[model samples]
Target: MGWIKNAKAATLGEDARKAWDAGSPVFTPILNMPSSNAGLSGRVEDWEHMMAAVLAIGWRLHTWAVCSDSRGRPQAQPLFVRP
Candidate 1:
């Protein structure tokens, strides 16, 4: 088997982190950075990059029960993390 956990525990980009940090309206997805941020062109390609970061850090697309503030959204979720 492969180390899915280890693989997912890799580096997450900064933008995705920033977007995620902004937080959602409790149940919605949160991603905002205007149409000027490097990959904020409102295109699918940009979203792909964001998704990569979320997955790399082991967050489910729309299932992970993780919560984060906008200031530090990319910080790892506590589920797969160790104490």
Candidate 2:
């Protein structure tokens, strides 16, 4: 029982780390060159990196039902729970 609990906690931590690292490719270029990252001087490679990250996370988002106001703050609405 103790080993099973520790394994479950470790798995959760690993999954969280993967999600965080997955966003870095999208953010790194923008962080290094915020002024140049927008339309005036956007790089195709950086956009591709961002798109890849977006695609990976897009599916995860479908698990939740999100409604946003004009300010874009997500209004939390319950989706479903698995037994």
Candidate 3:
């Protein structure tokens, strides 16, 4: 089970890197919530949701850095690694 999660995380990381290198937005499916609940929630916090999702899947936030996108907009990119 742990190995499977690790493999998934590794794949996701690779895909994210490729997208980032191509100056594309990295959309993490795990962080997405149902659109219908958007109004009810009002606002969604990123870090909180990320932490919850990663922890639930037996992973941890190894590190993060501020990276620039294609539009030169700064974004905090988190790297998740297996614990």
Q: Provide the overall lDDT of each model, using Cα atoms, as 2-decimal numbers.
A: 0.38, 0.35, 0.49
Return whichever of 1 and 2 wins on TM-score.
Answer: 1
**Which regions of candidate 3 are displaced past 4 Å?**
1-44
Q: Residue 18 in candidate 1 has what lDDT?
A: 51
- Tens-place lDDT per residue, model 3, 1-83, is 45544555465555555545565433343333323334354443443444454445545567666555555544456666554
* Candidate 1 per-residue lDDT over residues 1-79, each given as its tens digit: 1243223323334433454456522222344332333333335333345456555543445433434446534322322
Top of the candidates by TM-score = 3
TM-score of every prediction relative to native: 0.30, 0.29, 0.41
Q: What is the lDDT of candidate 2?
A: 0.35
- Residues 8-73, candidate 2, lDDT per residue (tens digit)? 435533543465566532211111212233334435343333334434433232243435545544
Segments in model 1 whose C-alpha atoms lie over 4 Å from true places: 1-29, 33-43, 63-83
lDDT of 3 at 25: 33
Candidate 1 vs candidate 2: the lDDT winner is: 1
Q: What TM-score would you give candidate 2 relative to the actual structure?
A: 0.29
